[model samples]
Target chain A: MPSRISMRFVIDSSVMQAAGRAHPVDKRPKRCRGFLDVVYGCNHRVVVTDEIETEWRQHSSRVAVMWQRRMRTHRKIWRPPPDAIEPLTDAIAGVESNRREQKLMQEDLFLLEAALAADKIVTSLDKEVHGLFRNAAKEIPKLRRVIWVDLDEPDEDGAKWVSGGVSLDPERMLGSSHE
Target chain B: MASRSGRGNHDSKQQDAGVTRITVAGFKSIREEQSIDVAPLTILAGANSSGKSSMMQPLLLLKQTLEASYDPAPLLLDGPNVRFTKAGQFLSRSQKGEPGGEFRIAVQLGTNDRVEICLGKTPKAGFGVRRLTSTMFGNTYELTPEMDHDAVRGQLPLAAKLADGSFPEEVREQCVWRVRQDRCFLGVEATHGDGDHWATFSYLPAEALSHELRNLIHLPALRGNRGRDYPVTAVGESFLGGFDAYVASVIAQWQTEEAGGDLTCMNGDLELLGLTWKAVTRRVSDAHMEIQVARLPRSTVGGEDDLVNVADVGIGVSQVLPVLVALQVARPGQLVYIEQPEIHLHPRAQVALAKVFSRAAKRGVRVVVETHSSLLLLAVQALVAEGKLSPDLVKLHWFTRSETDGTTRIDTADLDEAGAFGEWPEDFGDVEWTAENAYLNAAEKALRRGMKDAK
Candidate 1:
């Protein structure tokens, strides 16, 4: 049998915030850390853009501040495994569209460029920004886009409902409540 | 191919006298004359089995000629040929039996000197013996006698000693007499004693000639399994040292101008990110060592710092550094062949590689690359279009297979400064996306609909 194709999901801060997870105290944002923990442990690789970190610092500063406060109480919270934080300067430098939009899009553009460059499925929860990413994906070979709902939803039918922005069956979105 | 037009702006003051041209004859499916000029940046493209690999054969052949130890058997023949009709299996065609099956290659090393190597198979003259003649320069040399022993070991010394002994004592003393001069005809008997006899004294100088040829670095294509076991660090070290010297020269020009605040600060920040001036070292063990960006301690958080052992860092940083290190370490007068440097890299990083190749070319390293990614191609095209690299310095060959012969044909496309080529084949951009095939499929569907409507 052919080897199964492996993929990576690079998450942005906006997607993390939408998941309602507490921000990570020392390193990446809370939702990002949770998403990374889940994805990294699985067969798939997970990556975060410097842009995502910068955005978390700007739009999600309160989360960062909260994490900073928590870190004071828990000194161990600030440390990350050496392999976890990969600086994407070279990957980021390769993106032409990102360079063109550096002034206007800032960190978000950097994250988008990283997603496109990574040649893996970019997982984001923001519907508004999907078009820009999808268009960029069209220009790049092997690049794709996936939403958080698609990732969390167990079945295609359940994913369809969540993707349509409906919460008719909360259990489907949340998984088994008995557990 | 039609004549191409365009004069790219000279980005660097360094002048390229021009690339050395290689001509191949009777190699594989390439029955006729084939030539490829190794420009600063040369791209070989063609459809499957179309002579893209054949064009590269000369390089391999040159390597085989220069490297005395490499076995040349597997490089000569393709797969077994068989013909099975309703009748049954029959002995198939032999590639060696084809018209002009004999192979010859002439490599222009420089303006003044060129080496032409030829190989031909002759029928078996006697029991357990086949005649093979290989000629170097204008001198006709036969290898049939030496093939029983070691042809390379036996013949190389004989050829060199013969050439050397032919030189007159006075010319030998001068040490710089041209071969064309009649005074340099040192007799073969003086070196080898007599015809067909291996002289004892001839052994030492032949060994020396073989050593010189062995020193030539034969770069292999990325796909081959043979060189895969070669340490990545060794390749990285060579590429990095060459790349660093080139980058230093390019940066020297920018130093004279007053640095703009935002740009300088941004560059400084990027330098802190460990994109520039990072050392790469390989441990005796399998571990790869590279300088990487890391968060400073709480007291020195804002201060710039570099952490060693890049492999311990994220995959993106570790994976991308190899290309930079390779480019940085490439030396002048060396051939750097890379296959798909864009693999696992972001588009931004792809653009960075383009600049890296451009900078390397300016410093005198010849780069030959094969890529499937358009983004990477576009980035290089952009550099060419912007006049950062000369149009003549870059040549792109598109390969397509001939339907009749199943042989690949290569066509050259010239990229203008705007990254636009004069003529793009219908199947050029994407192999999966074909307008002609799509239109034909649509027409077939419409015709079927008309037939159904009539029914």
Candidate 2:
């Protein structure tokens, strides 16, 4: 049974682009597709920032586009204003020092900002950035609250978390909710 | 013209002159109150029998009532714009077929003023106004029948301000009239027009509202008949009937004017729509005139003398003529409600009509269109994306009927800067999507089968 508590999640463009591919051919895309289905069926909202929306429009397939359009109709798509984005981006830049990690952070930091703006939940396929952000969470208190999920990995299960109402589990979360 | 005092001076800002929003409740297929914001270019789209037309019917009812020669009923059930025989024909009914008690209609002006009128069936089996209320410039005024129903009492929050000569002079004069005269049926005053002038001012808001309704122009789905020769009728002070009926006479009137400016613009629009013909009116007789269209010369050497009667051309041209003419002659602050502007034209021509509607909205004519053409709507979206029309000036309302109760509900959406709707219903353009997908899937399947057979 699906949990009654609805969650808001920021779905990275990587997952959306793969979910849009032909479903019968690949195991990775099929998992991504199944995660989105579970997310929608459980009444969880999909959050997008301006940059995230632009990326989805450019790279996502027709399947993802149709899903997003339906989400808009159901009022289940949240577009949080950029009130906290610019400052948060600046903060992320200041916390990271390595040149290579800095470049990756700059590219994926928007997902964190959007997640912070909505619920502190993000479902992404980018495992490299997920590892980097988990390492950086030690320096930033706000980043500690982010709960990252990677459906591409064999061990990670997205459908259970979504159907269970995305409860605060320390194993899936970077750190504790309290600073 | 007596004392015309207390006439309210609304804000004359170009952006704030037309109707801004409308609300309807307890009307046919609309059991609950539904309100929609009116933009410069408003589109109403939905499935058939979803109450898309019912939402705008109240405005047409008021227009026809104000245009009636003699005041017979509070609302003219059967008229030129909309036709119905009895009050029960339009009143709301329960799921079990029980009729509702009363119906309410409200119009909100761009100036932030709102007027709401309620009507019910009277003892004589005729529709009568039960209550009229208006909120103007932060002041509220109401009128209703007295205890014995013999006299109508006025309720004004700023009665002292009205008596102190602070209100506009024209509104004061407009409000002061005999209640029983029925000249201003919207006022519903029963105070026998004695020396008590303040009692009459309560109806001032209704008078102003009626004036606004009278100024509205409507073009029904079915326009005037196509005829080779049109009789020239005298232009009335206001719209006496359907605006479509006055299209030819107005064209003739423009021909007699100094510049014939609107006629030239109308011809240009006709050409833009790919009609490839210019309309000209000839005075065949004193009271009769004929409209002829000449095809554009294919070459410079070709003469312009080859003219044919409008009736002889394609029916789409004559049907769209009235819509073009109405847009050309309309003033900036006026509202022109048209149903199905793309009736018989080709898809390309329907797309061209979007440009015409966008230009008219740019010129400050509030245009409300109810249509089923996805081509026309897509063209409007393109115009917004290209920055030719502001997304802020456009609003789209989708009406959906509840499958369970058969009542209507409206879901409104605004276009983003990219011309994409913020919230679009699933089935809005799903038929086209479904057809395209089906065709693609069929083609792919056939190709796979052919390759296997060759192997």
Best by the TM-score measure:
2
Off by over 4 Å in 1: A1-179, B1-19, B25-31, B47-49, B61-101, B120-279, B282-322, B417-419, B424-455
| Per-residue lDDT of model 1, residues B1-455, tens digit only | 11111123223322242225566656666656677776667777655566666665544433343332334231212211111121101111133443442565555543433444444443531111122233335444343323422333344444444546656554432332111101101111222333564333222212222232222222323322211112323222122211322222222222333643222432342343344433323323353222333433121444445544444544444444434434434444355655556565556666666776776666555677666555566667778767787777777877665566644456677665555554434223433223322443455566667778888
- For each candidate, what's the DockQ? 0.01, 0.08
Q: For model 1, how does the per-residue alpha-carbon lDDT over A40-92 read when each residue is reduced to its tens digit?
A: 22334444454555665655533333322222211212222445444444443
Per-residue lDDT of model 2, residues B1-455, tens digit only: 01212122212354477688989998899989999888778999888888888988887887787788877567877888889888787788999988887888898887779988888865654568766677887877666533223233335534435443544555543443223323224443322233554443343566666766776778888886657777777664355667866777878877776776767777888888887547878888987787877655131245466777788878888889889987766666578888988998889889999998887787777789998898888788889879998887788998899899999989998887767775455344455544433544455566667778888
With candidate 1 superimposed using the best TM-score fit, by how many Å does residue B129's alpha carbon deviate from the native? Answer: 15
